[model samples]
Target: MGGQTAPLVWGADAEGGAPYVFYHRESGELVGFEVDLARALERRLGRPIVFRQYDFKRLVDGLERGDLDLVMNGLEVTPDRARRVRFTRPYYVFRLQLVVRKGESRCGDLACCVKAAARIGTLENSAASRLLADLGAVALLYDSQVTPFEDLQLGRLDALLLDVPIVRAFLPHWPDLVAVEPPIPGRGFYAIAVRKEDEALAAQLDEALAFLAATGELRAILERWGLWDQGQEELLPPGFSGSLAVSQGSSPPAGASPRRLLTLALLAKAALVTVALSLASMGLAVLTGLGVAVARLYGPGWLQAGALVYVEFFRGVPVLLLLYLLYFGLPAAWAALTGTPGLYISPFWTAVVGLGLTYAAYEAEIYRAALQAIPPTQWEAAASLGLSPKQTFVHVVLPQALRLVLPPSTSDFVALFKDTSLAGTITVVELAKQYQIISTSGADFRVLVEAGLITACLYLFMSVPVGHLARRWERRLASAR
Candidate 1:
C-alpha cells in the first residue's frame, strides 16, 4: 500500500461517479472533469498521476494509510475532515439538489419535503446526511449515489439530496425523475486531500490549483463536463487564498450531551435490524444445510456430486461478492437478457439470500461431519427393528445428530450476526452503517470511540446468551445419553 516514493497516486471511487471521475460509457476509458484536473495537477508537479480506485467511504482511510499520496474524489472540505487531513483549494463548488419522481407534486422544495415528513435519501456520510438529520427527516443513507435515484423511481423514497453535478449527470437517463426547485445552497466545496503530515505536497497542490483557476484551465475542464456553474465562480474566485478557501462548517460543534443519547438510541435500533437479519439468514442456512447434508449422504450419485459442488462453490467465494452478485449483478443480467426492466430485490431479502446461501455451504459440512460421527450401528439396529427407513432416520439418527451439531451451529450463528455488517453495502441500515452515519456527522473522534465500544459490547451481549444456551443443551443431552 506504500506509495510515497512512487508516482503521485490519487485515490478515487469510480462507482456511482459520472462527470466526476468515471469510465466513459462508449469508450470504456476513465474520463471526467476530476480525471482531467488530476492529470493537469500531475504535470504541474512533474509526476505522473496514478489513480487508485476505492469505495467512496474508504478514501479517507486509504489516504491516512499512505495508500495514496492524494485523494481527488470530490472529497468535500469540512471542519471534521480538516482536522485529519490538509485540503487544497476548492476545485469545485456544488449545491445539493432535491430529486423527486416526475409529476409528483406533494413536495416542490426542500422545505416542503421536510414538512411532509418524507423518507429522504442521501449519501451516508456526506453533508447531505447532516442536513437531513438537522431537518429531522428520515434519512435513508446509501453507499452509492445511484441507489437513491433508483429508490426514488420506485416510489420507495420521497426525495433524494445529492450534489448538483451528480443530479445533472444521472437525471437525463431517468425520465421519471426531476429536480425539485430551490436547490439547497452550497454547504461546502470539493478539494484535493493530502495527509496532514504531507504539508509540502498539500502546498504544491494548492499552488497548482490556484494557478489552474487563474488560467481558466480548471473552468474549461468543468465546462466540458457541463458542470461549470455560478457556484464555483462565487466560491472559488481566481487567485483566491487556496489555504483558506473555506473555514469551519455551519453545523454546531459536536460534543457529548443529549445528542450522545440520541445516537445510542439510533444505534440500538440499527442493532435490532442486524439481529433480525442474522436470525432470518441463519434460519434459511439451517434448512438449506439440512437439505444439502441429506442429499450428499443418502441421495442418488449425481445429486450427491451436485450438493458437494454447491457447498464448495459457496464456501470458496466471499460473502461480500455473493451479496454484490445477488443484489446488483443478477438484476442487471436479468434485465439485459430478458429485455425487461431491471429487477429490484428488497434489501432485506437480498441480505437474507446472500448470507443464507453463503453460510449454508459451511453449515452443510458441519451437519455432514456430525452425522458421520454417529456410529453406523444405530441405523442398522433401527432397520432390524422393522422401522421404515424414513422413520428410522427421524426417530433414531436425527435427534443425536442435532445435539452433535448444536455447538458449532451456535458458533456459526454468532459469526453470522457480525457479518450482517456487510449489508450496509447494499443500503441496509444495520449497526455498522448507523455507526458510520453518526461518526461522520460529528467532529469529535471520541464519540466514534464510544460508538465502537458499544458495538463490541452489543456483539458480546448477543453471543453470550446463545453460548450459554448451547452449553446448557449440550450438558442436558450428555446426561440423557
Candidate 2:
C-alpha cells in the first residue's frame, strides 16, 4: 500500500520456529527458508524487503490493515483464507506429521490416536488442527510451533500433529520424540498472501516465483534448509500445480453466519474463564498479601526480612515468565527432586497460582502503605478501650486499612483481569486467545474487528462492577466517618 519506492514489508512470526522464519540461536540473526525466499524476491523485484514480526494468527489482519505488503511465513492455502486475501503461487508443499514420545505405544498412528480419542496438539487454526477435529481427536492448540513437542515429551499431549517442516526442524533437539512414518494424509501448500485488491503486487510476486522455480533458486533455498524434496517438484515448470481458484474473489459460503455466533459463544465462555481466574487470583492475592504485610510490619526480624525478600523477588520478575516457570519448570523441578516422571499441574491452576503469587507482592505493598497511613492515635484509642494488642489490631487497624486499600485493590483486580490474557501462553484459551482463534478462522476483516470489540466489551463488563462497588464502599466509609 506504500509508494513504489517504499520497501516491500512482509510479516512473519519468529516464534514459528526453524525452517520457517525463526531466530538463529548461534548467530543471533533471523534465518530460515522464508528469509532466504524473501531476499530472493527482493532481488527479483528490485525493491528492499523489510521483515515485520507478528503473531502468526495476526499476519492476515496485518495485511488487511495495509501494515504489510504481504505475509511470507508458512501461511497455507485454504478456502476460508482465500476469501480474505489473494495468495501467491504455492512456494512449498508440506504434509502433516504425527509425533509421539519415543516409547509411546498407545497411539502410534493417526488412526490409533483418533480411535482412542487421544489428546493431540497442533497449531491453532492450522490444517492439522482441523484434521484433528474432523477425526474426533481431542485437539490442544498452541501458538508456538515448538511448544507442542515440549508438551509431547512432558506427556501433557498424547500426540502432536504438525507440518512436516516443523517436525524436521525440531526433532533433532528432542531425542525422546519421533515422527510417525508416512506423515498424515493429504498435503498443504505454503505461499505468500496479499490483500485481495493487490492484483498488481500479486502478479509481480507470481512472476518472481515462476522465475525462482525455473532457475532452481527456489529449490536451492529450500534445499539449504533441508526442506526440498519430491513434493517440491509440483511447484516447478508450468507453475503452481495446485488449483488457482483461490486467487479469484470469493465470498464466504452461505450459512456462515452461524459460525460467527459460535465464535461469540466461545468468546463468552472464555470471558467466564477470565473472570473466574481473575477472581480466584485476587482472592489468593489478598489473603497472602495481608499475611506478608503483617509479617513485614510486626513479625520477628528474620520473618520480616524473609517477607521483604519475597516482595522484592516477585515484584522484579515478569508475570509471563512466572507462568512459564509454574506451568513447565515446576514439574521438571519436582521430577528431579522426587524421582517422579509425571508431576504435572493443570494449566488453569498453574495460571491461578502464578498470577496470584506475582500480584501478591503488589497487594502486599498496597496493604503495607494503607496500614502505615493509619494514625498513631487510632492505636492509642484502642489501647485506652482496654483492648488487647491482637484485638485492637483486628477490630480497629485492619478495618480502617481495608477501607483505605479498597480503591487500589479494585484497580489491581481490574489489571489482573486483563493480565489473564497471558494465561494463553500456557494454553488456557481465555478471552484473548479465543479472539485470536476466531480471527484466524474467519473470512472477513470485519469479523476480526467485531470479535475484538466484543472481547473488549466483555472485559469491561466484568471489570466495571468491581470499580463501582469500590467507589460506593469508599463513599459509605466517608459518610460513616
Q: Estimate each model's TM-score.
A: 0.53, 0.53
Q: Candidate 1: worst 10 consecutive residues by lDDT?
A: 249-258
Residues 1-481, candidate 1: write the lDDT tens digits: 1233448878776554565665432233456678778877766677778886555776775576555788887788889999988887889888899998878777788888888888899998888999889889889998766667777888999989998877877677578888876678655789889899898888888888877776667766776667887677753564554332221111111111111322566678888998899999999999999999999999999999999999999999999999878876776688689977456676779999999999899899999999898899998999899999899889889889989899899999999998998987766778876666444322233645787888778878877898899999999988988
Alpha-carbon deviation at 365 in model 1, angstroms: 7.7
Tens-digit lDDT track of model 2 for 1-481: 2346568889876546566764332233556678888878887788898987555766776576555799988999999999999998999999998989888887789999988878899999999988878877899998765557667888999999989887777676577888899887679999999999999999999998987887778877776667887888998896444322111111112212112322556778889999999988998999999999999999999999999999999999999999878766776688789887454666788889999998999999999999999998999999999999899889899888988899888999999999999987766778887676555332234645787899989999999998998999899987876
Q: How close is candidate 2 to the true structure, as a TM-score?
A: 0.53
Candidate 1's C-alpha lDDT? 0.77
Off by over 4 Å in 1: 1-5, 235-481
